[model samples]
Target: MSGIKLICGKELDRVFRDRKMIFSVFFLPVIIMVGIMSLVGNLSNNAQKDVEAHTSIVYIQNSPVGFPQFLKAADKDCKIYEMSDWEKATEMIKNGDADLLIKFPENFVDMVSGYKQGDVIPQIKTYYNPSEDYSRAAYDTISTGVLEAYRQSLLSQRVDNMEGLTVFTVNSDNPDMVIQDEEKAGGKILGMMLPYFVTILLFAGAMGIGTDMVAGEKERGTMASLLVSPIKRSSIVLGKVIALMIISGVSSVIYVGALVAFMPQMIGGADLGMNLTLNPKQIAMLAVLLVAIAFLYSAIIVLVSVFARTTKEASSYVMPVYMLILVLGMTTMFTTKTPGEWVYAVPIYNTSLALQGILTQEVTTMQYGITLGMTLVFGAVLIGVIGKAFESEKVMSI
Candidate 1:
């Protein structure tokens, strides 16, 4: 026990005492996360504002006498032009020279006024480039605002009473008709994304320093010093794994903290309906789950580091496992429904599932139990394997 403690203390001190390691592990992530998110948010908000303030250029063929008045009324900045040929106008829209092209049938107003029961209705055709932001915005505004209002006016003239056309209204004035589950609704957007980020960051935290700890030492010919010490092989392995787990766990917390703190502010004027709030019990469960995940990640990294001949070799071997972890975390990002209970028996994947459930306040005790138990079991087994590897003198001497 004393030997294990000594090894653990030495490893921890080595990391903490290094200024470069402290800055890279603890502070660099915070700076990059906040800087990137803030820059993206500013750019997005600027683009939206530019779109809103842009003046739309529209071409209309065979428009009714007063249709231009309606277009100008809806959007004062809309520049309307009369076009005899539509092919030229369509090409202009596609080429970004114009925002929209609308073709109204010849004598459209007369046809609507003279329409009878069971007669074919007049069709209005519109063209715009969906890839162009200005064209798409102009189409949406004209379709919903100007065109809808014109249709309603024509219908009112045809009917004796407009109220006769209405059958029923669906919660028109009362928005409280929704049975709001505040618990699940609060963190809806954040919940979907949080698990994926947490899972990836936790593993990344371990991967950063893990390879160099063992494999790097071997390459530098310093691992011999540890092997010759008056310490059991298992004790050395345990101490190193524990120290790595603690460092990675703290690193993961810093990452998660930065995300939670800056994410809302980073969105600026936009609202994603995110309102994450956790109860004490949920917070406790999350902490324990994160610790277990960190421990598992530490064990795997150490095992890989132990077997590799150099830091580069360890990194190459770790890449496949890193990709697997990335895929597992991404599964929860788009998954709307939870899987069967037995799925919790899986190791890294279960951590993502459990995290999603915990955020949404939907995780069951059994699910948590299965995931936690399986993770700890895998971590222990990996640690044991690493200990056995350490005992093989031929493996270490190389």
Candidate 2:
């Protein structure tokens, strides 16, 4: 245990001194998160502003009518561009010179009056470019305004005459169904991103530190020198595994911390209205899950590293494992089906799924215990296997 601690300290110092290691574990993730947030925030703000701006629409009619006055009165922000030719109006809209093009039927006034007097309403034909998002929104807004004006005209005519009508009461199981939109958003973002981020950072940290411990040592001829030392083979394996776990664990913490720090800003500026802040209990759960993930990934990476003749070979060997982790982490995004108990026994899958639950504040004690236990058990088995590999004469020769 003392030897393992000493080795862990040495490995931690080495990583701190290495500029490349520092960038990979800390700086890279921070840069990526901040850059992505800034880009998304700018795009969202622009979309909202564009939607708010009530730009000019070209109206084409065969005969003069009062409908134009109704549209103009609907919103003070609206700008109406009246045109006699439908073709010219359409061309303007298509060329981005106009926001919208409206065409009124020849008998539009008669049709509206007839409908108000208990006649069948004719379906109004509206043409819009489905490919344009803003065009669709503008069409909806204009249609809604026109309908409200027509309803108001009808109501004004019937203001002096009224009749009593029967009213029915409704009974509902969900009477006060108020959705806390903020909490829902927080839960959704955490569920979607937490697992993926944890898996990626864990794999990256393990690969970075594991390569140095095994293949790098071999290249430096330090493995041969270490073999001649009076240390037991199991102790050497233990030491390396501990060191790898520390590096992976520290990286996971940094990645998660970056996410937590950005959550308030994300909720405030973005549509996520969640009044969420992580408390000590949630932090503790996340810490435990991170530790378990680090241990499991470290053991697997060390085993893969032991089989490699060089750092390049170790990275190649680790690629498939990393891909598998990515696929499992993304399982939550595409799946609505609940994972079976057997899935909780899988190493990376268990930790990632559990971390997702923790972040969303939906994790149960039983689920957490099962995931943590399985991760530790698998890690122990993997460490035993790696220990045997390290003791082998063939592995030492490589």
Candidate 3:
């Protein structure tokens, strides 16, 4: 234990002293995150502002009733430009010159009236470019308003003619109304991203440290001298793995902290509308999960690196492992439903999913314990493999 701790301390000191390590482990990740956040923020803001500022909508009509009133109401939000040419109106939407384009069939008024009189009416067709996001939103709002107004007009006429009929209204209250907001939805998205980023940094940091410890030492001819010493081969592997784990673990902590520190300002002030704040308890849970991920990834990378003769070869060998971890971490990002129990049993998947659950404050004690236990188990297996590799003549020859 003392030997492992000594090696851990020495490796950590070496990492801190190296400018390249400082830049890669801490500076580069933060810069990449901030750049991505800024670009996404700008795009969202521009989309919303463009929708609000542009008011020119082209509508093609053939003497439709109530269409004038709909246009009048929508005019309060934006200027309505009614066009006779459907091709031109469509071109306007396609070229981004118009916010929306509404097209009415030649017999739309007749069809609507016939349907009101209990006759079959042909379906009314409304055309808008689906490729334009704002056009889609504008058309959705307009269609909803028109339908509601038409329904009310029919209801009023029925009520005027039926004096003997009575209408009863029943109201149901919703208890979960507080959770119905864009801010909550954005927070949920962030929950998915946070854990995945932590896992990525864990894997990256582990690979970086493992390459430096094994292949770098071999390249520098320091491994031979270390082996010649009376130190046990198991002790050496344990020392290297412990060092790599600490480096990876510290990198994970810093990566997670950077996100947590910036999340409130980024999500709240940005257009994402996530008004979430992480407390100390959530931060602590994230730290624990990150530590487990770091240890597990470090053990695997060290074992793999031991088989490589050079840093380039070590990196090449470890690339597939990193890719697999990335794919597993990203599983939660693309999924809407909570992950299953089997997902929690997978190594990297468990850490990523559990971290997401922790961020959202949805994690149970059972899930947390299971993920941690699985990580430790995998770490033990990886350490065992590294121990065997250390005993091999091929590794020494390398």
Candidate 4:
């Protein structure tokens, strides 16, 4: 035990002494997270701005008496266009030269003027490309506006004659208990996003130190000298594993802290409206899950590092594991439906889902046992492999 502590302290001291290692393992992640999130937020805001700034162009054919005036009154910014025929209008819309096409019968106003309350209503046809943003926008604005304006016109014609229409709207749900729109929006965003970032950071922190500890040492011959010393092979492996776990776990915590502190500012800039809140117990459980998962990731990375003869080879091997973690972590963010309960026992994904639940106010106490227990079990198996590798000259080759 003393040997393990001594060797562990030596490894930790060596790592802490290097300023570059400290910055790369801890600070770099925070910087990248902030930069990427800010870029995403900016791009998103730009797209929405473009959508709102857009103006629709309309093509009129056999124009109704008051439809054009109604459209102009509804949105004065609309650009009115005239086409030779339906064929020209279709071609114009198809070529993106126009956004929407409206056609009306020459006598359409006379029909509306003579109609009874229950008579067959005149029909108007409108066309717009569903794929074109301008076309869709024009259709939505002009169609709804023209309909309302025409209704008001008909209503005015009968204003003094009758009072047959009566309309009332009813509500059923309790306003106090139902979730707000912003809260639902915040829920989906937080539930999916938190898991993706945390899991990737966990894997990244472990990969950086784990590869350097065992594989870098093996390549440089330090591991061989250490193995040949008075210390037991188990003690050496245990010391190294402990150092890796602590370093990677601490680095992961730093990453999480930086994310929680600065991400909202970078991503949303102020009062993000995310409405994300976690109680004390939930946060404590989240820390427990994160620590256990981080240890598990470190053990797996160390196991891979032990098998490789050099840091480069270890990195090559670790890349796939990183990719796997990314895919699994993204399951929550990219997937339309959260994975089922049975998935929570499946190692990497379980941690991500549990983290999502914790942040989104949906986690249960049973999740702590399931996620922590399975992750520990997975980590133990990897630790056993590392110990066995310490006993093998071929695998731990200098």
Which candidate achieves the best TM-score against the true structure? 1
Question: Could you arrange the candidates by TM-score from highest to lowest?
Answer: 1, 4, 3, 2
lDDT of 1 by residue, 248-332 (tens): 9998889888888888667765776666778999899999998999999999999989989899999999989999998998987
lDDT of 4 by residue, 121-206 (tens): 87777888888777877787778876667777777785764334536434646567656666445655777777888888888887
| Steric clash pairs (candidate 3) | none
Point out the higher-scoring one by TM-score: 3 or 4: 4
lDDT string, candidate 2, 1-398, tens digits: 77666666777788889898789777787678767776777777778777677464545454236656776677556666666677877776676556666665667666755555566665544555545556666677766566556656755654554233215445557667766556545765777777887788778867867877887788788888877777777778888888888878887778767876776554336665445567788778878878877888888998998888888888899999889888988887665666677777777777877777776677678888899999999999999999888889798678
TM-score versus the correct structure, for each prediction? 0.95, 0.83, 0.84, 0.87
Per-residue accuracy of model 3 over 1-398 as CA lDDT, tens digit each: 76666666777888889898789887787778867876776677767777667564646556366666766675566556667777777788787677665556677655655556666644445567777776776677666676467555645654675435536433446556565645446558787787678768778867877887988888888888877777788888888888787777777777767876776444435555566766788768777777777788888888888888888989999999888888888888887787667677887788877877876677788888889999989999989988888788777778
Local distance difference test, each candidate: 0.88, 0.73, 0.74, 0.79
Q: Which whole-number lDDT from 0 to 100 does residue 197 have in model 3?
A: 81
Error of 2 at 35 (Å): 2.8
lDDT of 2 at 48: 73
Which candidate has the highest lDDT of all?
1
Which prediction has more favorable TM-score, 1 or 2? 1
